[model samples]
Target: MIFAVVGPSGAGKDTLLSGALAARPDLRLVRRVITRPTKAGGEDFEGVTEAEFQTRLAQGAFALTWDAHGLRYAIPHDQINGPQDVVFNGSRAALPEAVRVFPDLRVIVVTAPDAVLAARLAARGRETVSDIATRLSRAAFTLPDGIAATTVVNDSTAAEGISRLLAALQPVRA
Candidate 1:
């Protein structure tokens, strides 16, 4: 099983994912390979320059790759096989590929009220007001048409969110 966590910026998707990861030892988190300078708080997974990423892509070093928000992300095919469930804090562009590759894929979209998002961004103090406003202005994306079984509206605290995810992962008994 693979779980994809997605949401707009300032939606606390990362916070929720990280919390769930800490609690779930059985869950294997897949780190994304990137072609951008590592940000302060991000996990650096084989960072490379844009040219190098392109070269590697041409060499078939990536399973699926996509460019979004001026950054590139890739997932090597070998890193994903296993019975252990996986979790990803992936973008909207990556979700489809994830679902295609993993048979029992679950896509969870975390969201908060616009005002709540704005306040969370402000509290971070890393993003300028303009940056926050720009992000807030971007229209939120709905689940892709191809992926119908989406779980939406995760507005609870991080702990609560993790509990919800754990429950979602459990097998449904008839």
Candidate 2:
């Protein structure tokens, strides 16, 4: 199964996914390719220049790709294949395309209260106040019809979030 772990910025998707992977050694995490600099810091990703990114895109190296925050992100084709239950840091908007590509895809949408999200984004210190506000104001997304998804709230401790994620992914692992 391919699990697309998705949510808005500052929803702790990376943190929760990291913890879940630590506990579930059998699961595989897909490292994404992003146009952002490595130091930009969120998920561990392969950072590349725009020219390099486009070159790969033209070569059909990506299974799925999307643009956000003025940068391009992609999940390499190789990572989505194989029998392992693979998890990728994904965007909600790209879920439809992902579903089209991988019929067994499951989406895990991590969420938190608006206040919690704002606070978390502020603490990151990677974006300006204006950017944080813009992210906070973005509306929540509802999974499209016929899409299989599970929602996990990560409003509390990292352990709590990981617990929820693991529980949600348990069936997939089987």
Candidate 3:
């Protein structure tokens, strides 16, 4: 089973994912390859330069790739096509392609209110007020039609959010 964990920025996708991975050791988390440097530091990703990313893409090292925020993101071929119940932080813009690639892929959508999102994004300090404003504006984006997605509203405490996430992913235990 492949579960694509997706959400708007500051929805606590990483925090919840980290907690879920720690709680469920059997799940495989795909560490993405990004065009950003490792020091950019949000998620644990394989930071590569744009040239290297293009080269790897040309070499068919990825099963999936997408560009967002002016950066390239990829999921290694072996990582997705392999036999394992995998999970990864995925993007909304890439979900349609991802669905085509992994037909059985499940979409887990994590989300929160605008006020909560604003607060969290502010706390991160990675974005300026204007940048966060833009993010919040785009946060209301709707998922592609016909995609079966499970929405988990991560509006409360971390423990509550993790519990909700764990419940949503419980079928993976099978």
Candidate 4:
């Protein structure tokens, strides 16, 4: 099964995903292809120029694709198949498309209080004051109807958040 992990900015989705992967050796993590610079840093992703991204899209190289924050993101078709359970960071805006493409996909939605969300984004130092405000404006993003999702709130220590994420992922593996 493939898991689409999604959350608003500052929800610590990437951090929790990393910790879960570290603790669960049997799980597979699929890195994404994105149109942002590789060094922009938050999660592990392949950064390509818009031209290269378009080329790949035209070649039908992606199993799932979406646009967010003015950037294009994709999951390569070759990476989702295997014996082990696979998880990829995904966007909520494209969950409907994701459901259509990977019908059995499980969604893990990470969330945090608005205050926590605001603090984390400011701490990242990657976004300007205006940008952080823009992100916090959408902190209450909800999943589209018809999709069942397990929600994990990460307002505590990273360890606690990881534990919660692992618990959510384990039942699906069974």
Candidate 5:
């Protein structure tokens, strides 16, 4: 089963993903092929320069890829081999291809109030208020309906958010 976790930047998506991985050993978390270095509070993954990423793409190394925040992110095709349970923290723009490729994939859209998201991003002190505002605007409308989509509002502590996420990810019984 494929599990795609996507949300806007500064929505605490990475934090929730990291916490969920730490809490659940049964799920294998996949690293994304990013065209930039790992950010603070984000997982360390194999990073490639834009040129290298292009070369790999030409070599058909990616299962799915999309550009966001002026950078490219991809998931290697090998990572989705078979029906192995997998989790990925990615951008919302990457969801459509993933759902199409992995029919049984489930998607989680982590979210937060615009104000809260802005505050959290500001606390990080890495982005300007205007930048945070733009991201929040994008996050508000990123959820798509075709895939099984679940939104977990991150207005509370990370622990609280993770609990909600875990509950959402649990298999539903018929």
Candidate 6:
């Protein structure tokens, strides 16, 4: 099964997933190919130039791809073909395409209060104040109708959030 974790920026998706993976050795985390510099951190990703990204896209390297915040991101085909239960950071807007690719996909939406999100983003120091504000102002996205999804609030400690996520994923974990 493929579990796609989607949420607003700074909502602790990566932190939550990291903790979950550490505790659940059976879960596999998929590394994404991103157009951001390697120094910029959040999730573990393979950073590449825009030109390189375009070249790989043309070469059919990605199973799913999308653009957000002026950068492009992709999931390689091999990452989703494995037998293990895989999880990766994903975009809500791309869920349909992801579902089409992995029919048994489950979406895990990690969310937090607006203030918590803002504070977390500010602490990351990745984006400018203006950029953080823009991200905070962006409206929430709803999952496409009929798609299976679970919402886990990560407003507190990482352990709490990971527990919630793990509980939600319990039924599907093999």
What TM-score fits each model?
0.84, 0.93, 0.95, 0.95, 0.90, 0.92
lDDT of 1 by residue, 1-174 (tens): 777777778778777777777888888887778876665455647677989988888888776677887789887665567888877777777777777767577777777778878988899887899989988886277676778544545576777776776676665579
Sorted on lDDT, best first, the list reads 4, 3, 2, 6, 5, 1
Worst 10 residues of 4 by lDDT: 165-174
Clashing pairs in 4: none
Where does the lowest 10-residue lDDT sum fall in candidate 3? 77-86
Residue lDDT tens for model 2, 1-174: 789998888899989999999999889999999998898776789999999999999999999999887889999998777878899988888888889988888888999998999899989888799998889887377787788789999999999999999988877543
On lDDT, who's better, 1 or 6? 6
Tell me the tens digit of each residue's lDDT in model 3 across 23-138: 88888899999999999888899999999998999998998999999999999987765666799899999999999999989999999999999999999999999999999998
Error of 3 at 5 (Å): 0.9
What count of clashes does model 6 give? 0
Estimate the Cα RMSD of every predicted model relative to the unseen true structure: 2.3, 1.7, 1.7, 1.4, 1.9, 1.9
In order, candidate lDDTs are 0.74, 0.89, 0.92, 0.92, 0.81, 0.88
Summing lDDT over every window of 10 consecutive residues in candidate 5, give the lowest-scoring window. 37-46
Off by over 4 Å in 5: 38-41, 82-84
**Model 3 quality (TM-score):** 0.95
Question: Candidates 1 and 5: which is better by TM-score?
Answer: 5
Q: Note the residue pairs that clash in candidate 6.
A: none
